[model samples]
Target: MPQVPIVAAHWVYLLGVALIVLTMIWRANVVVPSVLATFLVALAWTHSPIAALGSIFNASFTAAKELFNIFLVIALMTALLNALKVLRSDIRMVEPFRTVMKDGHTAYFVLAGITYVISLFFWPTPAVPLVSAVLLPAAIAAGLPPLGGALAIAIAGQGMALSSDYVIGVAPGISAKAAGVAVSAAAVADRALVLSLITGSVALLLGYFAIRKFITKPDDGLLERWQAKSSNGELARIAQEGTFDKVELARGTAGDQTPLANQGQIDKALAAIPDAREKWSKIFAVVTPLAFLGVIVVMVLSKLGIGHDLKGGDAAALVGGVAAVLMIWASFVTDPLREFLDTSADHVTEGFIFAFKAMGSVLPIAGFFFLGAEQGLSAPILGVPAAQAPNLLFELVQAAQHWIPGNQVFVAFGVLIAGMITGIDGSGFAGLPLTGSLSGALAPTVGLDPATLAAVGQMGAVWTGGGTLVAWSSLIAVAGFARVPVFQIVQTVMVPVLAGLVTSTICAVLIWH
Candidate 1:
């Protein structure tokens, strides 16, 4: 393959990525560096401050356009979760899982299993609070150490489930979009699921082994000990991590609305009806789970050629549509007919607000990366014809390809490492575009599939930044719930999570290749 020449913009792009990584390592927000980097890169390319300023807007604008689908699905799913909360069904739904946690050993796996399932559906944003509030105490009483409980939640919910993002598909959607046309979200998601399971299984098993010695006989005092350890140590700051974590859970400030949007009508309806709300809550709890399960079943059948083939975007649409209908139904059940319109609007509004709070920070960072993609994004930002647009990042990769070993496995790990570096900012998602574009660029040179490489990159980015290894990320939320120090969560799970990531990367290279 011919080596592509490096240009001024290409050098600026590298420097920008390096500065962003350094910013993340310093534990600072990457938004400023990202914005600055985009401006500088644009300045280099266009050679005019005015054009660079315009490029900044175009970069972020283009990025938001590409990623709005991810935001929408997050909002709808979160809205559905809020509706479940309204019915109190979210609690009821998971209460049964507690009964199965008969002992400390069982509790560990049970907590992880339940977290993985819930996080897969609604994301760790909602699942963390739900599992921590309802299940964490029970798991603690069953003799799982608070730290153990925290590891289970972070490794399974945030690391494993979120890495794949199979249900919500936010992570994969971003990765696939940045990976270019040859790679589809469905393809990336499918590979991501396998990798996530591999990663989660290894980490969960190792975590259990690491904590098995501390597993005590079930005693009521266990919960007391755990609670006694809870202090105000950075508890207030824990809520702040939710800015990137999807919900301001502990603070209850993500999307707070009035306690009663239609207070009088709702009160009147509840007062007039005898146990109608409770009855509906119970009924919908059962129906809601079944409906989601059915959707999963249908999608599987479609994949098996027994029904219409739902592509990546189509799958997200299906999930979002179902969630909207379910939210409306659940809200209606909880709201008086006369007040239904206003009440449902409140829930949806809350969903969008929460979504923006959690995900809005990624727009600027994504914009910076988008400016480095293929002609479609860069041309718009650089104001060049598509055919003549600069492929700054990809060209750089090609120029440097000779410096990298030609071995696929070597290249695979390199991409994985690059992805992990990108994730240090802790958004878990802010790095997808860089890794995806790198994968697409490097795959042909290495005789591998871009989708496979993209999947590997996605795993690395998500598993690291999705909250498992970072103290300031959503791991703090887990620590807050378990009443442990945030660093303690990071330290305990660090090795196990790293092991899982390494194992998964190796598996991705061998299995998919």
Candidate 2:
């Protein structure tokens, strides 16, 4: 290990921070700054011109290594979700919530609650269309504003479910890995989950009040507003068939027909098994919940020393495997021979596409952060003297450790806020290794749990970057699907997101402290 330097690489780091801030202020990408910063730091430290060239390649490769698991987790979960959709189990999964959405107020809360729950397991990207397609129209008919529905989703799914990251464990795993802690550490997951819940609940409550008076009685007028703001084109297309018309049209349609008629035949052909409408719906209600519950059971059992020790990537593999199995069973049971193989392939393909779209941007971006992480990675990021090998960010943080406040809450919130600011670049998960490692190094001094602090940092990173707050992130797709202005979605979600952050911070301080 390189000894801490008496003279810090302050100027180099300052330049990096300044560049990042400038990029953010101008709404420009900071990837170049991240790369340039790595180069400068390495060059300045080593004072050799040639090493900068190598630093770039090695830094990105290091980043890819650290973050590949996150990409894989996303790919697997997304694939499983796609498979479920093809099997029609995705629709069946949410059917029970229909009963709770009898009116506007109920619909708003129901949407939030259901979105939060499902997004926790399967994630929000997949859950969004499923919920919006089914529950949204009902919510509108019940007088829930389309904007309100969008806000609820941003708060519950993107903010809460993702930030906590209980099921897939991507966020937590990244944080935990960086902090040198186990991914399934009880204290870590518990605190993160609680903080996420607190923030999400408070934000959602405040947000609902902000729009309370906007809720109207059930009316066709509400649908007009919903249509006016939402992606009317897609909704119109889905509506042309009328509510549940696909199900009806697909019911026992004969094979002999024209293309349109053939579509009905195909729909019937691919349609779920007999009374699958009711039966599969019930099964999903039971099995999906039970499957997740089983995960919890295994977690508890592992905690109690009864089963195989599962943590981090292992836990994720288990969850993904279960989802895949469910997909296979569901698809096969509906139409074992024909639709099974075809649907599985399509779902996996779509899943990979989505996974890349959601996470691929991070490669270059994270390559920038990884440069500051360790010298091994930085070798390619900065052209430097071979003898002067040190992790730039780690070294910088250590140099500043003397000046950092000693309070636990201050330390925790500082990491949280820093993570949030880092997320402003729109690659929310990009800053984890820095934050996590800092938390570990800082934890020893501030008397805080490294895992807990890392978890808090994760919430800031993921909720913002996962598309809840940022217009440029996944929020755009959400807004498009909802048929609303992206900025409108941001403004609507601002209050709730702020509330969630505050509440979650307080919860973390109180509980973890």
Candidate 3:
């Protein structure tokens, strides 16, 4: 086979990625560097300065269009959570779990279990609010440290559930597509599931032990201290400005004193709920979980080949649709008939604002990486035919392939590190195509299964960028909800997540090579 030429633009892309990774390690914002690098790479590849400027806009637009579903699901789920809050059904959802949580030791695992389950079905984007709003306070009240609560949610929801993405199938689907494999998404999903479990269990256990010394006896004082701490953080400013309400809900003091106008509105909203309708709060609480549970059961049955399988985006849509309907039902039950539509609209608007606040920064960063993936979004902007569009990252990796050692161990770790580097942008799934493409290319050279390599790469990308090791990722949501500093949570989970990644990679080589 003929060798592909290595161009100066390829080197520039590599340098750009290295700088982004270094910036992240230094605990600095990488968005500015990412945007600059995208412009430079586009300028070099297209040789047209004006076209390069256009590429920047096109890249971010493509990223937002591709990821808009994630934003929508987050908004729908958040809206559902807001409606639940009006009904106080959010608290009811976790009341039973609180009994089993009992103390710090049990609370840690309980939080992880519930978070993992819900995130697996609905994606962590949606599940985080529900878990944080309801179970987080319960876990805190049961003696889990605020940081501990954050770690459990990050490792379980973002790391474990998202890496497998078995129910929604998004992660594996992306990986399989990039690998150019004829295999089913389930082939990737199965391996990812086992690897994620190993990684998550190891990380969660190590995290628990690290924070064990900080655990205190069950006390209201712990919750109060956390609330105070949260009030001083970046998210607090949003809440103080009255733009965010979920923070107060997480602190379990939404009814606390506020501006009279705000208080009056809250009082009026509560008063509108007649005594008979109050029963619907508890009823919906029970029905909501059952509805979601049924969704999961049907998904599982489909996966087992007993029914039509809901794959990839279809599964996410199902969950989002269900949540939207539930939001409407809960809103109607909590307000007068004439006011329910307005109430629901307000909840949805708040949800969209929150979702954008949490994830808007990701768009530009994702755009830069998406360009490297030959996603076709930049072809028109660069004035190139789609077939001739450059895949900057893939070409660079292919050029360097001969220099990579033939050792399976070396290749596995190389892919793992590459995945981790790509993850520095802090959108875990955005880097999947790059890693998956590399995994497929390198696996044959190293005598390893492509699926196993893909799973190992997924582990690194999702675990690190997925929010456990990175402060600026979705981990911020975990930090915001748990009332802890984002970097502190990152510090607590770093060693454990690294250890888990190393161990799981080694296991993948042994089990599947």
The most accurate candidate by lDDT is: 1
- Can you tell me which runs of candidate 1 are displaced by over 4 Å? 1-4, 235-274
Candidate of highest TM-score: 1
The residue pairs found clashing in candidate 1 are: none
TM-scores, all models, native as reference = 0.92, 0.80, 0.77
Compute the lDDT of residue 491 as modeled in candidate 3: 83
Q: Supply the global lDDT for candidate 2.
A: 0.66
User: How many clashes in each candidate?
Assistant: 0, 17, 0
Location of the lowest summed lDDT over 10 successive residues in candidate 2: 252-261
Relative to the unseen true structure, what is the C-alpha lDDT of residue 414 in candidate 1, on a scale of 0 to 100?
A: 87
**Tens-digit lDDT string for candidate 3 (10-82):** 8888888777767655545566877888889889888889988887888678767866776787788778877
User: What lDDT is reached at residue 360 by model 1?
Assistant: 86
TM-score winner between candidates 2 and 3: 2
Q: Please write out the lDDT profile of model 1 over residues 1-513, one tens digit for every residue.
A: 566678788999999988987876665678888888888988887788998888878888888898888889888988888888877777667767877878999999899988998899898877887787778888888888888998899989988899999988888877777777668998888888998999889999998888899999889787766766754758556545433543244234213321111224234433544476888777876988898898889888988988888975898899899999999998888888879888888888988888788778888887887788677878888777888777777788777776978888998898888878877766677778778888878888878888888888888888877788766566666776777888777877888888988898888878877
> lDDT by residue for model 2 over 1-513, one digit each (tens)?
545764445468557766765665354556677677766765666666576556656566766786676666677677766555544566556655766777889998999988888888877766666677667767777888777888887788878888888877767766665565233334566677888888888888888888788888878677655555524454333223221121112211212211111123334533544575446545655786788789878977986889988754677777778877776666666566887788777666766676666556556555665455555545545544435555655566677877988888888888888677766655566666556756766776687778888888888877776667766655654565556676788887877787778677767778767
